[model samples]
Target: MTYDLLIIGGGINGCAIAREAALHGLKVLLVERDDLAAHTSSASTKLIHGGLRYLEFYDFKLVAEALRERERLVKAAPHIIWPMRFVLPHGNAVRPWWMVRLGLYLYDFLGGKMTLARSRGLRSSDAAYTAPLKGGHKGFVYSDAFVDDARLTVLNAMDAAANGADVLVGIAVESARREDGVWRATLSDWRTVEARAIVNAAGPWVHEMLGSLGVNAASNVRLVKGSHIVVPKLYEGDHAYILQQPDRRIVFAIPYQGGTEIGTTDVPVERPEDAQIDDGEIAYLCEAANRHFTKQIAPGDVTSTWSGVRPLYDDGASEAKEVTRDYVLELDTNGPALLSIFGGKITTARHLAEEALGKLAAPLGFRAHPVTRARVFPGGAITDFPTFLTQVRQTWPFLGEKRAERMARAYGSMLAEMLAGVQSEADLGSDLGGGLTELEARWLHDREWARSPDDALMRRSKVGLHLTPAEHDRFSQHWAALFG
Candidate 1:
């Protein structure tokens, strides 16, 4: 059977588009080469914020849209997405206080303020706040949001499937061509499907997708590699710090999964798939973090590291960080109507989807309804996160408070569904260490399309960062015995 839309990538953009289109009464098919969010999506810094730095590039429209979406995501998925206060400490070479304040003021007013707190200045004398830096450093606290990027992608795909979209994982597209009026696409996963229009939301491989279809538009993608390191928690509170480097790039030290998450360098890359965290990048990150905080973190302190390529739109910026974070969609109406997306932040994926579909509607001949604005995602059915926590406590009283809270944050209301048949912690079965249970593994494998141990540990859940080497080996053996 033919579908009205075929999404090439299973990253956040593709999944969001699939969910949006499916909800709008269109037949949709989404195919991914690897597991969902295995590439750039999962490797993100995992922030759902308006690009505060994008203001320097004069991308007020993009920042405004992203800021609004940030608040929307926080409300829509309270379990996974929440407000985060970012502390930006001023350095000698950084922007002036008046400029920073102006930017923050515009940011607060650009997007219609809702639940998130407004930006403010902090004094060094505030005893309630611990000064991680030397004296004479002022701070600017602003609003942002954090999300489990990998889980967000999966949940979007799951919502699309629930809404009647054919979600196909581990399926690679071999070829796609326009035939007469419809597009014929062949798959490598022992299946072939046809669609009227194709969305080349392949993230870093967007240009490659267009090349596969022999379509050439204005090529404007700059593959910049960004790397992150996960270490043990260094701070006690939920606030994250934005550290300024001497080179003018900023690094983030955020609280992640009860640990400290730090990242990101912007180096130009030749290929997207070749992105990896090299020794120099790690050292650079550590040096940047150490420059701002009293606690010095060495390479050994890094429990885990990941790298991703950002497909940024080249605007003739000499520095990678100066490149615009806004996304641009190029629509070719000649054959099969290819929609190629370039450079988008994770915070604005939903808005990108809406804008993309609006452009493709006339060509595809499908009237898609607008539902994503008010609709909640798969695990976002509830509004109050505390109420959900109370219900979960009542259901699984045997589970420890921390474990229950972790599961609820990760799986939301679906925690009950995931742990439905289990009565006690022992019933959850063998411990894979790092709070990972055998029952959770089976559920991820059976329901979440987890094929390998890395898929289970790194993407589906971040248990890999906490697992001991021997425990990880044992879990790999168990996974091989069951799947291989």
Candidate 2:
């Protein structure tokens, strides 16, 4: 079947573009080589932030764009995206106090009319803020939002499918060529699909897709490998910390899934698949954390490590951290229209989608309108998540406070739909542990394009963090039996 747009990549960009285009009444098809967010989208610092450090490089435009998108995303998916307070402790070694304050002021101003709290100072004696930090250190607290990045991508894909777009996962576009005013793409499974326009949102494999189509892109993609480590809870609070290394690079210590997640070293990578965290990166991260927090961490303390290669737009920066995080969209309307996307962060993905569809509207002959702003995702209908949580607990008294809240956060407005007809805990079926019920897993597999147990465990939900090895085996067996 012929389509108006064929998107190659199931990452945030591809899925988001599909949602926007499909919402605009376009016949959109989005195919991904692996599970949704099997790569970079799931491996983020999990922040819907405005790139606070970008101010140092004078990336005002990017920061402003990100901040605007950040606001929209929080509104769009209140279930997955919520306000987070990040504390940046002042040290004599890093940027001066006056400079830091100026940058914070600019960040808040550029964001413009945000629901989150404004930046403020924390005195040295502020016990709650400075308890984990080195003694006599002052700090500043700023607001951003945290997100379930993988879910964000999945929800967009779901929205696209709901709007009559074809969402295919675990299928790679093996080749593509312009044929008689249309682009024919060959899938890995040997199926051929034709489209009026194509989008190369393939992330790291963008250039490879271009090569397959015989289009030599002028812009280059710089593969930068960023790795993060998950360690035991470093601090007692819900607030996250931003630590500055001697190299002027920033590392985050965010409270995640009953633990602390840190690291994300910006090392240049030669190959996209070479996203392994080296010993040096682990050591560097541990040392960076050790310098700031009173609680010291060693390499052995690390419980988990994850790495993702960023397909950043190459600007000839000396260091990986110095490279720009802004996206670049290249449209080649020369035969069958082809639009290529390079370099974008999760915070700005929805805006990128709107911009991408706007560019393709004329060539693809589609009426474009803004829909995602007003339309909420499947589980993001509620305005007040806290009140909704209380109601969820009241209705389902069988679930404890933590379990009910986790369910509400993960499924949001869909929690009731997912838990429909379940009158008691036993009715929910086997506890796969970590509040993950067999019924919930089935729903994810049946509805959310979850193919394997790992997809549900690691990406769809972070229940893997709470599951033991034996429980994981049980989950795997149960998921296989249910799906296979």
Candidate 3:
């Protein structure tokens, strides 16, 4: 099939671009080699945040761009993205107190309109907040946000598909060649698809993808592996902590899924798939938390670990940590115009998509209009979560408050569509372990392209976190039986 645009990679960037392109009246096709967000996009710190530390590297523009996108995401997907205060303890830190405060002030200012609270100082008397800290009498609190990163990516793909874009998962572009001013891409299964323009949003494999296309684009990807560990809950607050290590690298201890998630170690890697959390990275994360929190933890305390390679645009940075987090869009209009995306964060993906479309508009024969900027993702129509959740609970009393709230947050306005003609828990079909009903599982499969148990558990919904080993096995069996 011939498409106006063919996007490689189903990560946040690719999905966002697909949605944007489709919204602007383009026939777009997004193909991912693996499951949607099965890699780096899912492995993020799960925050829609401005890189506060990026200011140190004189990256004011990147921070401002990310902060603007951060605000947009919170408003656009309040279900998946919400503001969280980050506690940055002042004393016994790598950076000076003045510097930290100045940075926080700039962070609040850079983003323009503040939907969240500005930075403030926390006193020692605030025992509820200070009790968790091991040291440092004073601390500064600033706002960022938490997100279900995988779900965010999936929602973009969902919206793109809803807008008439073809989203094909588990399909790879094995080879591509310019044929009569169009990209003739061969899939892994030997099927061919043609597109007027091709977008290389392949994250870590940007260089490799270009190479496969036989395009001699500059290989500028610097693969930096960032690893995170999930451990037992460290503190009793809803707020998160950003601790400064002696090495000047900041690590986050976030309240996640009834546990604490501490990470990440920035280690330079040779390959894109080099996304394995090492022993040293785990220990470093544990130590980073133990140093600040009163409750000490070790490597043994880790319940889960995740890693992803950041495909930064190589600008001759000496260290991996020193690399720019900002995205670089390279447009090669020589033949069948190749738009290569080097580096980008989830927070700035929407804006990045807008920028990407702007570059491809003339070449791909489309008038680029910023439509997605005002639009929300699928199921993101509800702005007031609390009220929306209450309505969901009232509408489906059988779901109870907990389940209704979960549904409201996960599916938002689309909860009704999933629960249509259902009156009771019994009507939800089979109770797959951990509140994962047969109906919900089928919804994921039919609409979201969730083909396996892992896609349902890990990406579509986090119901797997509550499932027991035997229950997981049962779910797996049920999935195989239903799909196979």
Per-model TM values vs. the true structure: 0.95, 0.98, 0.98
When 1 and 3 are scored with TM-score, the better candidate is 3
Q: Total clashing residue pairs per candidate?
A: 0, 0, 0
Task: Tell me how candidate 1 scores on lDDT.
Answer: 0.85
Q: How accurate is candidate 3 locally (lDDT)?
A: 0.89
Model 1 Cα lDDT, one tens digit per residue, 93-140: 377779988988998898785788898887656543446664445768
lDDT of 3 at 288: 87
Clashing pairs in 3: none
lDDT of 2 by residue, 1-484 (tens): 8999999999999999999988888899999989999998888889999999999999999999999888888888899999999989886348898999999999999999988899989865667778888856577989998899999999999999999999888899989999999999999999999999999999998898899888989898999999999999999888999988899999999999889999678988888899889999999999989998999999999999899999999989888999999999999988999999999999888889999988998897776667776678879999899899989999998878888987788889988888888899998898876778888888898889999888998998888878899998988888878888
lDDT of model 3, residue 148: 96
| Candidate 2 backbone clash number | 0
